[model samples]
Target chain A: MLQVIRNSLYFGGVAALSDVSFSVERGEIFALIGPNGAGKTSMLNCISGLYHLSAGRIVFDGKDITRLPAYKRAELGIARAFQNIELFKHMTVLENLMLGRHVRMKSGVLAGGIYWGKAQKEEVEHRYAVEEIIDFLEIEHVRNMPVGTLAYGLQKRVEVGRALALEPKLLLLDEPMAGMNSEEKEDMARFILDIHEERETTIVLIEHDMGVVMELSQHVAVLDFGMLIGFGTPEEIQANPKVIQAYLGEESLLEVQG
Target chain B: MTAVQSPFAIGCGDFRVNYTQDMAIYKNVRVRRRVIFLVILFFLFPILAPEYYVSLATMAGIASIGAIGLNILTGFTGQISLGVGAFLGVGGYASALLTTRLGIPFWFALPLSGIFTAGIGALFGIPSLRLKGLYLAMATLAAQVIIYFLFNHWDALTGGTGGLVVQRPSLAGFSLDSEMSYYYLMLVILILTALFTLNLFRSRVGRALVAVRDRDLAAEVMGIDLFKYKIIAFAVSSFFIGVSGSLMGHYTLVITPENYGTQISIEYLAMILIGGLGSVMGSIYGAAFITLLPVVLRELMTAVREVFPNLESIFIGIKEIIFGGIIIIFLIYESEGLAKMWRNLKDYIKLWPFSY
Candidate 1:
């Protein structure tokens, strides 16, 4: 469904993603894992059209969307959740998801102004779609609640729910399990797996948690100092020399502290 | 935390329920009936009330319509505009000029002037697509000053600082030259405007405006065109304010440049602030309160001055002091505004029998 072709580009006299490339198959859970400043998020941003590729092309679903705007990409069934959960805080959860259904909505400003006829019919249909996602996410009780009042973990889930409301062909989850407890991590992993297996949604996730990635992702891409060090299955990723070397220092430190 | 309940609680208890219930213009059956009753009252009051009271009510009705427009922009869209008077001025001048010079019928001039002013407001709001908050407010403020300047200096178009005399609007050969007829017409327009605005909240454009207001970046990511919605907000608001302006112009039989200036914009803001920001009924409550304040104060001032000679200036000073004080007190105590306070009081009475 997607691929990233990297090149030796200078980021303020430093190389960010150095001539690296990888392809993700449709309906697969692709995990991007790396240390801090590894440019994992940068690569995701390029894929999502938040930032333009400096030296390569981004072809998605047999179309070149390299120069498209973020919203345009979203219109083409590309949905992304931010690393720091970006929900419309003052708006109700329903309203937030309703906004997610923005691309699919067929009504124009003129139709909305009349508030009867076609607009009302379209609104009722959209409401049904949003309610289905709410039921799927098990957020029925807090459906009308403002996302701001929810706990951090629930907020992250709501963000995913919003992206799901888009019913995208490709979903980009940026650090969905960041700053979560073990219980929350399990919940998030289960949800991500459900998105991949049940909905047949192509998912590209940036995750720092090794266990979650190994358990949930079928393919893994490792980044180190803005370079693609490894790309393969979780088993292959664990056995990769560069991957082992990357985690060795942290592992030894924990051992020494113990 | 005391876990205090708001006196203004009307819908379901929590924010979630409150939000869902508020999505409806008339939340419950009772509210719907009340709205219908008010619509009837709007058309009836002019015929039923005395001439002076009818005039006052008409002015309130007109101002309320304008305030509702301002509320949509400032309260819902989170774009602070200090140029309601300027937009109104555009409408007033457009209607006055069209009716007097072009010989267009009053009925045609009213809506045409509104559309004309909306165009002008959209022009001013273009910078709004890129600017926000204090910057946007300043841009609108600059627009207000520029409009006022043009109104004063453009003698050819606006008849100079001497102002333009407006011919009363007539519909279907029936003259609205009298106060009663003007009042009735204004009342009908006001009710229609309010109803239109009420329905707007449930629509996509309205929802988009709210989304942009809450989190613009998120909305942009969600595929909402921020520039389009923001400008639409200004345009719709201008249309409503313009209609109020056109009505006022015809009713007064005079279109003075000074009448539509920064002071009136401030007065509208004060009404919204004192009444409640973002609440629909707040606009009406606030507009009525502010419109009637000077009159109420004048009565008190006259009585006080007569009882104690040489106290007129002091009473006037006290008016300004109290005016500022009220705004401050409301901001500090009930930041949600008087409408919230009103709602809370009603809720407290409704729930009084139950123990905490």
Candidate 2:
């Protein structure tokens, strides 16, 4: 469960997000839909503690996480996949996933190098968790390959798998299906559904693909010029006049239906 | 998952059963045997080699320790430091002062010096949180100048330009006085440092350092403390460098500011760059190559002079140019360094008769 109350974010005198408010319930896939520069990413950045809010606060799992650092928020079970796939390019897919288990691991330099008992055990446990993610995403083939060498669709899957590797209570996915082919998009939609159903993960996804968003999200929030224009179920959001005018426009609604 | 038969194959090898085996230092029995053989050969080298070559090997070993330390910071962590020479001086001076003034034994002084250098390195690393790349390099360069000035001018503490005389360490009345004895001491330490460094990446911290090197923003979101890891990298790197400095000071029985100047720091940087960034064994190769180049060049020049006695003066000027040219060529053609080249060679050998 997460709550953002009237969050405002500014960059160099320009308001990236203004008075935007939304709440995501546990075990729900919430979609934030908007056109370009609609503050979807700004809101996600604010929630993840990457950007400081100028006004209001964020509450996650009953704690005020407004001022927590990014890593601290990560420790509190927040994980995110970037819009552009921010993976460690030089590292293998397995290494990138293992990094997601970083906070859970407790080996210092000495124990890590020596790796005799406790460190060795921890590494094995984490590797098992990472391998499960690799299998779940069907990226076992590229598991040992550097992330940079993977195709764009595979890299996006790897990024999502990396977030899943954290076993987070809340996962933020920013454009996870962007630049993906139709088959890749279908696979990603299925993976998102599986994560929501089987893992019971609360997710807040920012997406431009209206079809995927409407199909997968239990709730939808539409943004326009840094303001939340509509918040409802998929059917209600489809009929909302303001959302149509600001985001979907008149023609795209028929496209969504067709 | 299907097993494929090789063209020139032995029996199917034992596969890794667990994470321990998977993350082992040696991947197979052959590698383990080769490593053991190499270690034995290193230990027995001084017995077969002459005194001059033994001394050169000892110098290479000492340089290897420093190069490995530099590689951990610059190569692994992606933090550029132009202050290795000053850190080495800090170690040498700290050890020398401890042994001479407080009358501490060499063993105690050695570790103490490492700690002292680590502290200084951490202090220098503080600005790295806000700085990166060339700016961070300039900041570390400032550290080199400041520490060098202190070592040069602080007469009471560092003995000024006159330098300090250090005694060779002895254990239980057994002096490490001879070059061979000292070579053994340095060799043992080098092996331990190599093993420790090689195993470092198998741990969480080591992975964190590499992650930071690859992408700091992503590493941060993954819950790695970027600043904490950076400082730790600097401190750990300086620790090994300090130990090497102490060893060198004791071996030579002298500590001078000139020995730990900016040129020496550059040379160490060259070692890691030529050896391969982020490689443990690459550091050894780099140290050996850089250490022996001048000697090899001088020998070549002498041989050339004997052939054409009038060409000596031009050879002297051309030596520096050749050194710079070789480094440039390596950077242009083999930017991954000698380690990657060596790996490519091994792969070629393994896949012989089939160019695939």
Candidate 3:
């Protein structure tokens, strides 16, 4: 359950997002689809609290989170995976995921220094949870490996696995399958389906793949030049002329549906 | 996670059978035994060696503490601080003032001095929230000048350029008047410092610090508050530096404004760089190497002077020259520092003559 109302963002004189609003129901996968530079990633960034909306309000599960800091938003069960793969590059996948559970861990510098007591117990508990995520993402073998040297698709999966480690109420994924091959895409789609079906997480996804978007998402919102042009179910979005015109340039989305 | 070799692996690996085993700091009994052996060897060295060498060991041990503190901030957290020398001075002065002026015991004064320096370090670290890289360096450089100015001009507190004097600390009612006893105290503290920091980097706090270093944005998304952690890093780092400074002052029975200048900060930086950034063991090796360089060169000069009297003047300043040259060579040859070299040595020995 998340709501965005009258969302607008600007950089100098240019509008990155303008008067865009949308709402997602609980336990549903929501899709934000648009052509290049159509503000989908910016919208995700805004809702995730990485970028503050210039004039808007974001309500997450009945809490006004528009002005909440990014870290605070994370504490409030919001997690995000970046399009550019913003994982901690030099740290191991295990450590990266452990960082996802940071808001939950209470150990401080002194406790961490003398780490055989409370800090060790907390670390082991979190490590077990992280290992479960590693199992879910099928990356158990690479748990100790630094993500910097990981392959692109694997790195992308680690990104999602990190977000999942938060046990988040709302998860934002930006272009998760952008550089993935068809088989990797299929695998990622399966993982997303499993997460939705099993965990019942509310996901907001930014994607360029028409088939994946239409098949996986229950609701789709199309943006064109910073404005919301269409908001409906998958079948309804495929038939909308404005979405057909602005998203995938008329023939491409129509061809996917056909 | 990739095609490259995982650096976290122990030699030949495959030992872990469970999650608890996997999370262990010492991967095997052999590694644990080896560490104990090395620590025992350190304790035995003073008994076997001369008092001169023992004094040198004390200095190296103190330097090790300061260098480790710098590594936590610069190496692990990726926050460059040019204010280490000033922070060390803060500790020395704070402890000296605490013990002499307030008549507090040495045990309590040491940690109190650390807290004092941490306060100052956090104050200087405030600019780091908005600055990075060279800009942050400049801000810390300003801290160096400002703290140094206080040390020189704050006559009532710091005694200005005349500095302060301290008595050797007594532990559990045992006065550490002898060089050997003091060396033992320094040794024990150094071991604790090493163990504490080694424990630190293996846990969640260390992970958060490294996350902030690698990508602050991603860390923020993961709920690691950047400002809070950065300030914590500053405070934690300075705490150790302050303790080190206090130890140095007590050992020498004197604390002066001249002791901690910009050159001292540069040397500490060199310690982390040469030892290996982000490594507790590397800090020790680097500090020992840097500390012993001048003394070793001086001894060699005396021995060579006996054989060839004409060669004496040519090597007059060779200690400084060799110090700069070794750091440069280390930078080019092994940027990861001596810790990496030590790891390579272990790997090589494990593989043996096969050389894979």
- Model 2 alpha-carbon drift over 4 Å, by segment: A248-258, B1-8
DockQ of 3: 0.74
Better of 1 and 2 by TM-score: 2
lDDT per residue as tens, model 3, A79-150: 999999999999898888888889888998889989877888999888888888999999988988999989
The true-versus-predicted C-alpha distance at residue B229 of model 2, in Å, is: 0.8
Give the share of true interchain contacts found in each model: 0.51, 0.82, 0.85
Best by TM-score: 2
**B220-316: candidate 1 lDDT, tens digit per residue:** 7777778888989999999888988988888888898988899888888888898887777898888888888877888877888767877877777
Query: What is candidate 3's lDDT per residue for B222-246, written digit by digit as tens?
Result: 9988999999999989999999999
CAPRI-wise, candidate 3 is medium
The collision pairs in model 1 are A6-A19, A6-A20, A7-A19, A144-B16, B7-B344, B8-B343, B8-B344
lDDT of 1 by residue, A1-258 (tens): 886766444567777777778998999999999999988878877877767667887889989887887778888898989998889887788888888898898776567766676877777788888888888888899987989999998899999999998999999999999999998888888888888878899999999888788988889999898888899999999877778778676676455456
DockQ of each: 0.47, 0.77, 0.74
- Per-candidate Cα lDDT values, in order, are 0.84, 0.91, 0.91
Tell me the interface RMSD of model 1, in angstroms: 2.8
Residue B162, candidate 1: Cα error in Å is 1.3
Clashing residue pairs in candidate 3 are none
